[model samples]
Target: MAMTASTAGRRYSNATYRAMRRLKTVGLYAGVAAVLAYMLFPYYWAIVSSTKTGQALYQFTLLPALDFSNYWQLFNNPVFMGALVNSGVVALVSTAISLVIGILGAYALGRLHFPPGRMVLIAVLMISVFPQVVVLSGMFEVIGWLGLYNRPSGLIVSYLILTLPFTTWILTSFIRDLPKELEEAALVDGCSRLRILTHVLLPLMGPAIASTGLLSFILAWNEFLFALTFILTDENRTVPVAIGLLTGSSRYEYPFGQIMAASVTVTLPLLALVLVFQRKIVAGLTSGAVKG
Candidate 1:
């Protein structure tokens, strides 16, 4: 009788342990789902609101009304179209320029031995942390002096202040973590430093480049203060500034639907880019996290 009772008690304890573990797993998944919903709800709402028009827009429903008149109106707006082009030009050009410069800087800082290397990197980091508002006056004076004010070139130059530091820092860290054997082998093969960087390191740095470039593009694309302050003409404005200037039929009315539509339009491309490069971004971010 005692032996049977002990066996039964042990079985009960095992069963309870399994149940508790399952419950814990379920709770963890539920918490993750809740967090996802919280983060994604705003994007979902923007998309739904973009599809709504007239009285349907004001209705508090989770589902879209299936209307697309807002998008039609958005595309028909010439100013928005022009702004879109300007934003693309600024973002792509700035990202490309920053990457080129950052790669060179990263190579020098990461690969070469220099006395003031750490100091230079620290200065770059300090520059990066500076608030846009603080540098606005200085950047404005420089832009005017360079004859780039009221031009896309001004926006691009201003964006370098934001993008270049980030790219340089990230690329520097990534390159520092790379094996020296690759560059040594290239050098053994009669490759010059520039050739080794271009041929050997460049190919291996794709993930880092993609990650930094995407971030730089996003920063430039969504920049507002510089775009607004620099570009005087409506035709030269970027998406963020142009969207802010969007007006409704009457002075008292707000074009909520059109604004949402524009928001969705600008956001979709970024979403697509993220999804496409999701693997690369993850790989780039996690490359040096663990070692054999």
Candidate 2:
């Protein structure tokens, strides 16, 4: 009788432990699902709202009416279309320039040795810590002095202040992880530093470049203050500023539907880019963590 009771107690304890483990696992998954829903609900709401029009837009329904009139209207507006084009031009130009400069700077800082190299790297990182508004006055003055004010060139230049530091920092970390043997081999083959970077490092740096360039592009594309301040003309405005200036039939009335549609339109391409390059981004970010 005593032996049977002991055996029953042991079985009950084992079953209780399993039950607790299963309960904990269930709680963890439920928490993750809730967090994801919380984060994603706003985007889902915006997508649904973008498809709504007229009186239906005011109705807080989960189901979208699937009306695309707002999108059609936005595209038809010359100012909005012009803003889109301007945003693309500025973002692409800034990203390209930043990448080129950043690659050269990263190579020098990461691979080459100099007395002030580390100081320069720290300074570059510090530049990004300042708020855009903090440097707004100085940047505006510089833009005006350079005769680039109200030009796409001005926006591109201003964006360098944002993009360059980020690209340099990320690329430096990535470059440091690359093997030194490859560069030495190239040097043995009579390859110049530029040649080595262009031929050997460039191919290996694809993931880092993609990550940095895409982020730079996203930064420029979404920039508002500089775009608004520098570009006086409606035709030269970028998407964010232009979208802000969007009005309904009356000045007091806000065009929620059109605004939501514009937001969705601008956001989709970025989402696609992030999704496609997510692996590269993760790889680039985590590259230098391990020595071997």
Candidate 3:
């Protein structure tokens, strides 16, 4: 009888423990779902508002009305189209420049043995943290001196300040983590440093390059303060600045629907880029986290 009683007690304890564990798992999932909803709700609202027109924008409707007049109007706007082109040109050119420079700079910093190399890396990191607003006046003066003011070239040059440091730093970490044996083997086979970089390292750095380039593109694309301060012409403004300056038919009215539609439109490219390179970004980030 006592043995049977003990067996029943053990079974009851095991069942209680499993119940507790199940409850904890449920709570964890619930919390995660809540946090995801909180973070995503604003974007969802923007998408919904993009489909609304006029007074419908002011109303809090869970379901969108499927109206696309706002998108049609935005597409028809010359200013918006010009801004999109300017953004694409500036971002693509700046990302290309930064990646080329970053690859060479990171290679030297990672592979070469020299004095002040660490100091240079530290300086690059320090430069990245400086606020753009602090350097606005100086950058503006330089732009004017270079005769690039109000030009897309000026924005491309200014964006180097944003793209170069991070790209170089991230690439440096990736290069540092790479196996030195391959480079040494290339040297033994009479390959020069440039050849090694172009042949051996470049192919291996596909993920890192994609990650860095994507980040640089996004930075240049979404930049507003410099674009606003430097670009004097409507045709040269990027998407962010153009969206901010969007006007309604009447002076007293704000075109909320058009604004949301523009926002959604500009955001689509960024979202697609991120989604496509999500794995590469993750791999690049975590690759050098632990040293062998």
Candidate 4:
């Protein structure tokens, strides 16, 4: 009887412990689901809102059907088309400058040692933290002096404040991780520094360059303040600013569907980019995290 009682007690304890462990696992999954829902709800809301009709939208229905009427309307509008063009132009131009300037500057800083090289790297990183508003005063003055106000070039120049420092610093870290032996061997063969950089390091650092370019492009695409301040007309305004104007238009009472549709279009390119380079980006981010 005593032996049977002890065995029963042990079984009960083990069963209770397993039950508690299962409960804890379920709680953890519940917490994750809550957080994921919080973060994703806005995007889901936008997607649903884009499909809703004006009456159904105003009715505040919870579930809207997936329809392309709003998308069709957005594309039919000339203003929306113009905004897309302006955004493309600015993003392309700014990315081009950032890529060229960033690659060369980062390579020089990372590879060639000189006085205050570390200080320069720190300063470059700091530029990324400086608030965009702080530069407004200086940018406005420069624009005024150079007569670049309202020009596409002015927006491109302003975007450098957003792109360059991060680009330089990020690419510097990437370049530093490249094999030093490759460059040394090139030097042993009597190859010039510029040739080694152009012919050897450039080819190997392609993925890093692509990551930097993608980031710079995203920044340029989403920039609003500087574009809003400088670009007054339809021809020069980027998509974000133009979309803001679209929401204020008197045509059919600030169509939510149209605005959301345009937003989806604007965000699609970034979404595609993130999907394509997801692994590369994750690796780039964690590259030197555990350097020995």
Residues 43-123 of candidate 1: C-alpha lDDT, one tens digit per residue: 899999999877787789978888899999989999999999999999999999999999999999999989999999999
- Model 2 C-alpha lDDT per residue in residues 1-292, reported as the tens digit of each score: 9999999999999999999999999999999999999999998999999998778877898788888999999999999999999999999999999999999999999999999999999999999888999999999999999999999999999999999999999999889889999999999999999999999999999889988899899998999999989999988899999899999988777799999999999998799989999999887777777774
Q: What value does the lDDT take at residue 243 in candidate 4?
A: 82
Supply candidate 3's per-residue lDDT for 229. Answer: 90
Give one digit per residue, the lDDT tens place, for model 3 in 58-169: 7998888899999999999999999999999999999999999999999999999899999999999998999999989999999999999999999999999999998999
Rate residue 5 of model 3 by lDDT: 100
After the best TM-score superposition of candidate 1, give how far the Cα of residue 263 lies from its true spot, in angstroms.
Answer: 0.6
Which segments of model 2 are wrong by more than 4 Å? none
Q: Tell me how candidate 4 scores on lDDT.
A: 0.87
Identify the superior model by lDDT, candidate 1 or candidate 2.
1
Model 3, clash count?
A: 0
Give the clash total for candidate 2. 0
Q: Give per-residue lDDT, candidate 4, residue 203.
A: 87
Between candidates 1 and 4, the TM-score winner: 1
